[model samples]
Target: MVAQYPGMWSGRDDGATLWGKLAHDRFRYMAGIYKVHNWIDGGSGSGHNPLFAGRIEYNFLDPEPSPAYYTASTYYGKAHILAIGLAGQYQVNGVGSALQKGDYKAWNVDGLFEKRIGTKARYDVYTLEAAYYQYRTDGVCDIASSFNNHKADYGNIGGINSGTAILVSTAYLIPWRVGWGRIQPLLRYQQFRFAHHLYGPGNPKTRQFDAGANYVMDGHNLRFTFDFARYTPASGTQSDAFLLGMQMQY
Candidate 1:
């Protein structure tokens, strides 16, 4: 939800951007300036103004040693970590129809903590993560307008507008392995509050809960997940789902 909410990559729209990052043992900073457009419709009236985005993180324990700007959700007991981050985005005339354009702005704060306990040969891994997001637009960029039109206007400007969201997750990796992998039980929750609903007149909110387990063969490189989810929406009937997924890195 955090990745999709702020329109990460500006909804993957085509454009040119200048991005850079500064990383150190104790902190990391990344920022970018983008002149994005809806090239899918030949660029049209998607505006020429630039969009600015950036994120900064401070590490209180062992620093994330990755050279990349992004960090993983967990390190699989490889490192002890305690980190907090802040991120934001802004653009003038970023959304709404051509005649009623509006500015777009979003911000979020997140934190992660991971620790390994027990003996060196049988250490258990624990991880916890949480994030909060707020997004807004100043003009007539409601859900309907944003979804119905995407060529002339940036519209929904990242699939969301004028709302707040939150996500929380936790996981515990067992110290003992089972066959080729170890089992990690996890729980996650997400909630979204929209200032304007896609239908009707009332503000709508949605909540989801997920319980799952991962078979970790080589950390995130080789893993399988089995999950069950339940969703509740302000105006819709409750729904449930079962998901099976796998991940592999070569």
Candidate 2:
């Protein structure tokens, strides 16, 4: 089981320090029809790899297109979440690392349906969703000398959680818009029962919360936002609390 050397490998900088998506809060909120997208491109200035060099990119386009390469666009029909987007990928040759898997062109789609409970009039703020797929592209099925490393969890079957589910979720949104801006709070409860080592044994269910304020400008159709989050799990393992960060949309 020894490869002679042990070191952590990295491909893309999707997120490391940030608190990540506050599923407790809607990443975006609007009543009417709209189109949206977001992108974040960053790299490490430190941590030179023991054998490989770190990344320096000219644009959001990286030599390794990993999970960080995502497109967020939504299409809603009568207060429902209908959007489809997938992250494609490009792998470096012979390395077994997706040094630049930019979104799978084979499975690539813009986004998919994201639905809430009711229509905009009633402001039904709760919803649940998931996506699954499986394909063989001649990629390695072994990692750490094991095919089990590819097992799926959360109701997905086989190497792809394509048919099974290990979890169910509940969501909530409380929002208000005033003359100055808009404010919203979000919450999510995730339940996982499938017994898999992917998330570890005795994997506890999860609960998360996010709160934010948006400065809405009608003239240019701009919304500037600041948010924070605190997560307490039904089965405590990785709980967190932090001032999330920021974003702007129109």
Candidate 3:
């Protein structure tokens, strides 16, 4: 897969092309190795920065990694399941500007678990995901200042910043019938904190509470979701947001 973002120079595009293959499919243990080249070609200055990443995973209870989406049958099964993953990334010429200074890199590891209790008609669904990320930056200008300004969040905005982040989210799916679809009510909480200031002077931290429901029609391929979220930052008043969305796939 190739990830591309609109470049700061208007016409050029920043690209991170990744290639990988999944290992032997015995249904229990799986792994994949991927290499990525992140750079802005044909843009201004010297943009030859790149990053490479790899991940390995193991599943217990069931014999495979779960599907990418939660509305699939893989998640609504009658089994106690657990999956663990470890991943890392390395970067060269971390700063994408001609005035390159330092290199940036990060390591991440995560675990996911799901369990279905009782029968399909009166079952309880539980899922938990916890992840940790460690970052190392040679300097405050590690990421091109131009590039950081283009990002929408702290996670993507790189800099002379070194920090660790911990995130844990757990959601319970209660499947209740509504018309021809199944309505699954979900409750989730997430917290993220950075040891150093991610955006500026103060520590960048946020805690969010989300309540949502999904109308699963034809699984995740065709579904509707309604969610409400409240975010509490390190400072300032809490912010609230709502989302109503639909997904369609062939």
Candidate 4:
């Protein structure tokens, strides 16, 4: 096992990892002018489930812009998903080999798209995203699930095959005014799939609903969001999980 997961470097700037490097100005063509800001996601459970992503936004379709609410022939904004990275499942005890055992590998290849419709008062937004993930499965020596659960799988956590996964999601955004600025609410649906040859290879399907608010503050935007998911195994299992997150971008 090498020392690191993706290693200090993957050799090629754009190797096979799948993380795309796109820019936000790419969306401005449609909204006349839009801004892409940088921000971070932090909270108590932050490191518990680590995720790093670079996103950009562009405003296209707006004809005239003079500060005031000017309605062009059409007002629509586009958001480009530059890159997405994630830290897989965290296992308290497992393998010392980077991704071969303990802790899920932080697979990086991912892509996403976003769109906004309407002017200042009300608008509808939609986003589509996809990613491939390969998490860590407990080694044969471990007597519990790779997720650090109580039960043990006889299949030995499923080996390198355990981490392979494909995920996709779609979301909707609705913006409204509160006191001084505006608040945007978001809803999303997601799906995850296992490549069939992994450990314990069970087919688990999930339904998700996420809601969040975005507030603008002097060129800086602050957001808070919550997500809920219901899982239905393709075979025989019933369970549910939910997550919450907050973001700040300017």
Question: lDDT winner among the candidates?
Answer: 1
Considering TM-score, which of the candidate structures 1 and 4 is the better prediction for this target? Answer: 1
Q: After superposition, how far is residue 100 of candidate 3 from its true place, in Å?
A: 4.3
TM-scores for the candidates: 0.83, 0.32, 0.69, 0.40
What overall lDDT, based on C-alpha atoms, would model 3 receive against the true structure? 0.54
lDDT of 4 by residue, 124-235 (tens): 6655666565444343221222333412332222223233445555555545555765444444444444444443456443333344444433213354545565555445
Candidate 4 TM-score versus the reference:
0.40
- Expressed as tens digits, the lDDT of each residue in 78-138 for candidate 2 is 2355333232222122112233211111122222333445446544343343333222223
Each candidate: RMSD: 3.9, 15.3, 6.2, 13.2
**Error of model 2, residue 123, in angstroms:** 6.7
Estimate the lDDT of model 4. 0.35
Give the alpha carbon lDDT tens digit for every residue of 31-102 in model 3.
322222223332222344445545556665564434321112235445566777676655655543435444
Best by the TM-score measure: 1
Q: Rank the candidates by TM-score, best first.
A: 1, 3, 4, 2
Q: Where does the lowest 10-residue lDDT sum fall in candidate 2?
A: 34-43
What digit string (tens of lDDT, one per residue) describes model 1 on residues 1-250? 4343333343543334443334456677777766532212322226567777878888888887564355888998887999999988887766555555667788999999999999888899999999999877774353332343543344323344577899999999999999999999999999888766433467677889999999999987899999999999867789999999999987
Better of 1 and 3 by lDDT: 1
Candidate 2: Cα lDDT at 66: 18
Task: List residue ranges in candidate 4 displaced over 4 A.
Answer: 1-109, 118-125, 134-163, 190-198, 201-221, 232-250
Q: Choose 2 or 3, whichever is better by lDDT.
A: 3
All candidates' lDDT scores? Answer: 0.73, 0.28, 0.54, 0.35
